[model samples]
Target: MKLESHQFIRYFEPEQAAQISQIAIIKKFNPREIIFEEGDDSDSLFLVLEGEVEVSKRSGEGNNYVVITSVKSNGYLGELGIIDRKPRSARVVTSQQTVLAKIYYESITEILANTKGDIVLQILSFLSQRLRTVTTDYVNQLAYKEKMTLIGEMVNTIIHDFRSPFTGIQLSSSMLKELYPDQESQEWCDLISMQVQRMLNMAEEVLAFSQGDTTLYCQLIDIAKLLQNFAKLNQVYIDFASVELIVSVEEGLIINADENKINRALQNLLSNAVEALDQSEGKIEIRARRKDQLVEITFSDNGPGIPQEIQDKLFEAFVSYGKQGGIGLGTAIVKTIIDAHDGKIFFESSPSTGTTFYLHFPIAKID
Candidate 1:
């Protein structure tokens, strides 16, 4: 049968339409035949003249069918290659005896050039509709993934925060049991109370984290003093890794910022640096200075650097290096805090020299 009047006029002008019809040839395939395979470099559009085809991919033990859009007498397929210049994403197989009008890219382009006015508008409109549909689908997928990630983070924070209170409860309950010798009932009651308090603390932390109330108030923070405090606090981790924490900052270097957030960011960097050292003797240099009204802080560690492939996405949520038991949210949280403060954070690293995280905060301008 001839190309439908509406389909022909929709894609090309009368003259070009006739030319395309003359040049196009109908190709037939048997059942289970390969019409096109994923990654094939064939930029051709196929208008089904008869039968059906299935687009799918092989996964695990079975074939996963993604799209089963039919291509009946006047329907089409293979337009993705023409638009994106990419290979097919799935294999198109002849589910049954199939016939299609194969129009190569050259012919399509020739027809498009010759076509004018509403004919061009129609073709473009069709392409635009298809593009919008695909874009919407992709955005929805990303949104779904983001929702799942947030849920996972909430669960993890609950578990992490619970550990502290749980440990405290365990210790307290054990002490109570030792004090109440032969009073088994009282000891069990103490244990239950401790466990309940532990759960309450865990619930509170989860609620706070989920509510996004982790950021504290802004104040004038002394960078040098903060580093000293952090060093003392994390001395155990530093010593366990045989790492030396060296701090260098201009005396009296004060910045107007959220002290808690900055401290958290610094802590994250230090933690990452220590982990990167892999329990080896390493040197971590924390330096801060005021450069042109910007407070620049640098965390440099002498350990194995990040790989090139993962560097670009280092600050993205849930992206972890080779460290076991590492939650990749630290850098992501640091970036989030910096961005909220209108500051910037970047890093540079190499295999032998290790990595350095550079954070810059604009000094509060005074009248």
Candidate 2:
């Protein structure tokens, strides 16, 4: 049923309703016709009178438009852009042959000048609601960006810590096999050596969380303390996920860095690792040390390794590895934070072999 201006007065005041009836033009749009594209400067408000309209935005690749929502008969659209004088953020198109009441910006102004105080209040109230919706959407986007940035930083730190131990374990294991010729006890020694090497590899994976070649701030930092505090804060998630976490870092190691951001970055990486494991029994290892002018950290997990195809772009925002319901923002956050701290990250992985990240930060000058 088509709603008359008087019947739809709930959306506008009596005086405003009268003004709309006088100036609003009823226009018919063909099916699949575009009402306006994003950034179009048609400052007009539209009220759907018949059929439906869809609002959508062009996806990142521009090949598709992700529909935000739809408007049915008696529903209104476009007031926000018209009132605020901003470009339309999304396109609106007719889903069928649609009839709409179009009120141009000039008509709205004239109506407001002639309208009663109560009618003006009603219009203002509707605009306020639209503003709130836009503000909430903006806040969500900002938060997602911040989270991705933090994840990136953590990956960088993990790589740095893993490099030294990985190098040592690789070199030491080879030497140990050469020096100890007894095959009987060699198997057990090899087991211990293998575990150590795995630890080193995990560190490298964590470090790889940073996307590319970037400068990092070196610093002396107490790695053990950092892990302990992080574990305490995230204990609920750890317990809920049935994940085991291990930490190893000397107390006196002072690493040069923006330690606070590093902590946040690591938190994001670890949280994602735990989530990736789902309901399975997951284990995470964190190790760090200060060597020469560098501070290194590694974060490794015993869950499924990243898929080969996605592993290459895992650090890019919204690049998920076929994980159901995954938004793919965690590793991106890890990269941004690390970049801000002037650090580097690297990753290593194989299916079922698990994944590890290495992070490196430069140490503060001893002098």
Candidate 2: Cα lDDT at 44: 88
Best-fitting candidate, measured by lDDT?
Answer: 1
Looking at candidate 1, what is the lDDT of residue 237? 66
Query: Taking the tens digit of each residue's C-alpha lDDT, what string does model 1 give over 1-367?
Result: 4654436434665677778777777788898798888778768988777788775544336543344233455556677776776877667887788888888888787777766777777776786776566556556545645664575577777767776877777777677777777777674756466445535543443344334445557887778898787676667667877888998888767777876667667777887888778565789999989988898999998888988999999987667885788757678777877876879999999988899899998876544
TM-score between candidate 2 and the true structure? 0.40
lDDT of each candidate versus the true structure: 0.72, 0.71
TM-score of each candidate structure, all chains considered together:
0.53, 0.40
Error of 1 at 258 (Å): 1.7
Q: What's the true lDDT of residue 202 in model 2?
A: 39
Task: Return the lDDT, model 1, position 310.
Answer: 91
| Full-model lDDT, candidate 2 | 0.71
